[model samples]
Target chain A: MKKDHIRELVVLSGKGGTGKTSISASFAVLAGKAVLTDCDVDAADLHLLLRPEVEQRHAFFSGNEAVIRQQDCTGCGTCLDICRFKAINTTGASYQVDPVACEGCGVCVRFCPASAIDFPKRNCGEWMVSTTRCGPMVHAHLGIAAENSGKLVSTVREQAWCIAVDKRIPLIISDGPPGIGCPVIASMSGVSLALVVTEPTVSGLHDLQRVLALARHFSVPAAVCVNKWDINPGQTERIEAAARSAGAEVTGRIRYDRSVTQAQHQQKAVVELTTAAADDIRLVWKQTAAML
Target chain B: MVAKTHGRAARIAIASGKGGTGKTTVSLNLAAMFGAPVQLADCDVEEPNLNLFLRCEQLTSTPVTMLIPEVDANRCTGCGACGELCQFRGIVSLGTRALVFPELCHGCGGCIRVCPSGAISENPHQIGTISVGQSRTIRLVEGRLEVGVSSVSPVIRAVHQQLRDDMPAILDAPPGTSCPVTATLLGADYVLLVTDPTPFGLHDLKLAVATARTLNLPCGVVINRAGEDQVGLYQYCQAEALPVLLSLPDDRQIAEITSRGDLVAHVLPEYGLMFTELADKLQQEVLKVAGGRA
Candidate 1:
């Protein structure tokens, strides 16, 4: 059933503090020969869990930030006045820079009185193609407070897909960002399937709806799984019902266990931890494989 | 007819720019220490986890809806006025008809506002549900936006409608500095930013701080998983002149307790006293702000 161009992507919850890195790592191990990509560039933690052996690294420029030449600024202040990002600030006789406020928009480059402003492609982050025990993993790190996570996710996913094709693999299991935002949307574009892993809580249910809706919008087949279902049976049932109502397949319900943490503490997958959680995870992986 | 104001209480929202920074833990514990017949609103409608930490009885919930413009083709003039009026650019004009991207529509009614003809009619779009519940001490209200609904601001606004006077109120806000967080922070007396000690934590913590400063609200941080990540958070706070109100260390027992769907304060009795102290410090800060405003 392996297709030349098919790939499977998974998105974790938006509610951080969830054990997404650990769970994704487990899935990676189960996926053995498949290429993996960590698309949570804004806060990529799968690298921490997988300990990927980075083979190649490169600077990634998502867009351009307007850089002003001080000598040519002329103290006219037109660039400062028109910039929506307020990246440019006028001092007594000169100007100052506020990189945090800069959205990398080029309004200042066009409006500069002395034509001193130069728009350079902003180096937002670094992308890497690395080797993990599971497979070749594509991941990236977005610089502190830098936006363009959507672009980074797309970049890594594209590379991951390309690598899978080159390797003649059938699957590219991508770890997507949480929420129904731009990064999550980017993670879903053209994927054969998206497995949405969520928890059994109020916010979990709320975010699940949004993420699922996003999957529906993209016309991608989606499957849902509630991690730590034992903690809240009522909420878990509700999530299951919600998923069913939306025509999404509920792949598996994972019970809460201390082994998940123990596995993380030992730097191993839950399936290797020899616990009920591990058993549940193996079954979940089986379901994922069936999807493929 | 205009209804009474009912002397509703001021809502102080607790928010962060990133998730899992302990927003719900801080917000719920804050309500617990306020010790009055207070109302706690979880405005993170997309994920209302505030209820997970609180024991609530007697819940009343309602479905919240937003307007999705449905154009009547019979009366439509194809003047392109609706598409032109849409600020979000969600409306796509075809040669003879128009398509609407419901996700991008902010429900601002701007398109309807500008339409010369009476072709554009508002259709009810059920985005989420708002619920009211009661713990032993405080009343709880939360909004759960229907999954896949793009706009959460309206659901947040609905949660805000449950504000009550005569007691302190805490609004647990969703992470991010987007429209939903803005709606939750509106008219709040104070904003407490919960954060952690990692690189991403500090990065997003600054965003929440900037957002709070821009809104002119008194803000502070409650560092969750304190020890290993403290340096980054502390440095940022000192540089920004933001106070580090409290620190919750990386305690495995606490983590296990939370994993069991119990708030750390509930499982660790000692943290109850800590939350009380945090509340006392916050009250002093809130009073100072109020005095200045007067």
Candidate 2:
């Protein structure tokens, strides 16, 4: 899926709330005509900043869900004993499926003696093709307590790629989810460059290394930027050293600024304002743009 | 509401829809303020850093495994039934035999039932490990998911499996309104959502509130980084009827101490009262809800 024409840059952080969305929104504004995507489907906050207007919406379906026909169910406790997910609830005369707990393994559906279980496609969430003041964008809202975030992330990326190709967009800016897990990996594939936003702390350093290792494992080139580097100068230096040792480019450092919050309150990217952090983000964009 | 099995131990889960909204900070502080007889569970298994600040002495560690199918080729009939029934494609019939992928398996056991030859059996596949430790009076239980493992619910369930019936537990839920957060909130008596006053915090907090409502759990909000500019968030909370249980200051001193991995309650001393008050309020809520259990 690697394209020679478009440069897709993904903003990621192993830890959450490290300004990934803030930085990505700035990059979108800077890129101007790029295709934007919010890969953080679990707790998507990019749309709050971009304020995209939805033009098209698509239903997302992934995996199967089990529903018991209560009228036909015999309350035999057979599915309860067989389910490992603890999804089957017997608090009533007839067994009920706790949709949140049910992983939809379909084990109970197959084992039911009366064949009372129904296996249906799970409507996990919805993905949208929208238009922001910046440009065409893609985002999604994952159903509450629903699984398959990784799948939803993939779906968003796929639609973004299609829109980019269709529109002949030369760039893509994505806001990625936190953690070094499945959803994070799903966002990494076919990405041209990864900008890892991190803060200055022990947990930040610990998680940054693990995420760097994941990037190395996937052979995805990554650049690390320490957000709020002034808060802990010592830890910031240590993190930069680690990023260097891990063969990643230490791109830029942003100070902890109140203007970042002010910008958020206005639903604008920090780069759109006159602030020290905006200058720092511009330098990051300059460096990242050169690499791309 | 589920009935409490043991004598008076309220399970309070501190969760956030947005990442880095102080779920860990709140959970750790409340556990310290609760002062012993409390179980601090780190259900955020993917990148568990509670051990970073807790610094407890390790007691025991156990691997959490999911049952995946191991096909016995010797007894195989190659009927392709296993592949046909598997929704996850964890097991596939390749030409003459069935191949099983442990990582892909949901451990549903459907393939085993579908196989006419009775060739499939289940084996334990390690996904994560649960470790128990003690920090002064509070017992710490943290779940660490294996690096490559995708399924986090099993590891979360393993951490909860270590919860004691008699002692109160403060669960540090992973950020987001997805399945993992839901898994942590399910058995809790009350959910304390910690959020900042920023617009991003308000936006994500709405999602978390919807999730708690969908799960039918009684919950309240704690606004971190509280500032005068929080009229937007305050109004939303008022409109939603979500109680603001506590609000921490938007002070630089708090951030410096917190980011340095110090429990604000222990280091600042005066701020300990906030957590103490939070504990008393949650205790009343738990007691009130315990009586109305199904």
Candidate 3:
């Protein structure tokens, strides 16, 4: 039993604009018993699809933002010019800080001429452990246009792993952020397997190659599942061959289905829809689960 | 002493504040419409999907390398100077040793900046690769960042090396207005922000437009889902004095075509006309701003 106590996480396609969240939401529903984590902290949308009920909330401090106090000193613009983020600006009378643009480097605060600028640790986002109708979900909402998505993703994944360990669940189905950038790297690292949900497109193949290479770089076993595979069967075949060449397997190929939109409109997974697409996704889930 | 003049290409960038707003779609179509002597650099290296639309045949690839800190155990004195100087807290001293997390290192040479014992040295590591290609009609360049490498700016800078003096280059930027997006739009003449009309879309749009304005780049909006939501996009563009060059309809046919790895311009000839018009408009705008010639 102890040996069977293994934690598993899954990252979808490296390409954005794909239906990664939707497919992962469907899997979350079918898992019957598993902890879900939304690792797409940069543009967290799995919460929209999962509709989690916040059971606990925690403030996340990924980094800091510089705050300039106009009352404290002269309008010396040393901090403004030195700021790599261009986060500080003069508003006629006072110098103000744009929190979103600030990279939180503290260079401005450290070298303020008047010592008026201070680097304040900001609550850039909120991480939550929630309960979904399907299962317990761990997610976070990064402040609007905030940076440090990689850190936010790592925080959410850590919480999800903790929950899975506490519940004695072997699976942690994570809806990772798209792209092979910081957030994607954070989501994919240390995962047992990655199910890359790609389409049959040039960008799809290109991104899949990068993501698969990332998996190999991390020594994680990866599987490919082509979403809307019927849209371009030729490209799908190419992706399949590429996956095989990369020493990975194609777990499933989901066809393009209009009912997917209808199910999403109803805030339901495609597997719950009374359509053939649902059946295909159900099979995809079966294979993905078996791999875990 | 002689003064030298260096000619540079007109670098244009196609970006969106939000994902799924057809940035890559617009970038490829515009590149195709621009005719010859145009280089399409897919700087969305993390997902470089423009190749899907362009169907480019790759030629040369340059690996993007960065300086990662390497600690010489013999020279390291557990001084913790490197750790203390690291603003990112990437370097940590564990008892008699120091650990350098390559992922956290920004390659700023800051760790080496404050290393007292000269234990820290620069180690060149490949973070990504930049590839040049041809899509029959257009020249293509793309950056693919190696996974697990946290930094992508170096790769983007690497992709920037393929620009020719007279060639019109279209930079396909990644979504969001972060460091990566800034890197993509650094030297661009004009930035076309492909956005939709949604709260999240609008929120990020404001951030990106502000960024473009801060950088003193000429910008305009291209609403992807024209009919779906017009009020927010139109209102924002009107308020900001940003021109709306193109508005793509939310047609499922376009989606189906794009999903099939085919460019919309190829499937829908009408979209080609739109791209041509868009390119013309951009040219006129560029001439107006930069003036006919030096």
Write model 3 residue lDDT over B127-146, tens digit each, in one string.
88888888776888889888
Tell me the deviation in Å of residue A238 in model 2.
0.3
- Clashing residue pairs in candidate 1 are A203-B47, A203-B48, A209-B147, A209-B148, A210-B147, A210-B148, B9-B164, B9-B165, B128-B146
Report lDDT (Cα) of residue B186, candidate 3. 73
Looking at candidate 3 chain B, the ten consecutive residues that score lowest on lDDT are B1-10
Per-residue alpha-carbon lDDT of model 2 for B101-158, expressed as tens digits?
7767778788887788899999999988999999977899999888666688888978
- Where model 3 places Cα greater than 4 Å from the true spot, the runs are A1-11, A67-102, A105-117, A165-171, A190-192, B1-13, B17-21, B34-39, B49-79, B89-104, B107-149, B154-169, B182-262, B266-268, B280-294
Best by lDDT: 2
Model 2 spans > 4 angstroms off:
A70-78, A90-95, B1-3, B6-8, B291-294
Q: Candidate 2's residue-wise lDDT over A1-292, tens digit each?
A: 3367888899999889999999999999888789999999888989988999999999988888999998999989999998877788886687899888888878888889999999999998999999998889999988988884588998899898898888888888999989988889999987888989999988999999999999998889999999999988989999999999999999999999999988888889999999999999999998888878
Give one digit per residue, the lDDT tens place, for model 1 in B172-220: 8876664467667764878888887764466667777876776567787
Task: Give the alpha carbon lDDT tens digit for every residue of A140-179 in model 3.
Answer: 8666445646788888888877777777777889988877
List per-prediction Cα lDDT, in the order shown.
0.73, 0.87, 0.76
Docking class of 3: incorrect
Provide TM-scores for the models. Answer: 0.67, 0.95, 0.76
| lDDT, residue B290, candidate 3 | 70
Name the candidate, 1 or 3, with the larger DockQ value.
Answer: 3
TM-score of chain A of 3: 0.94
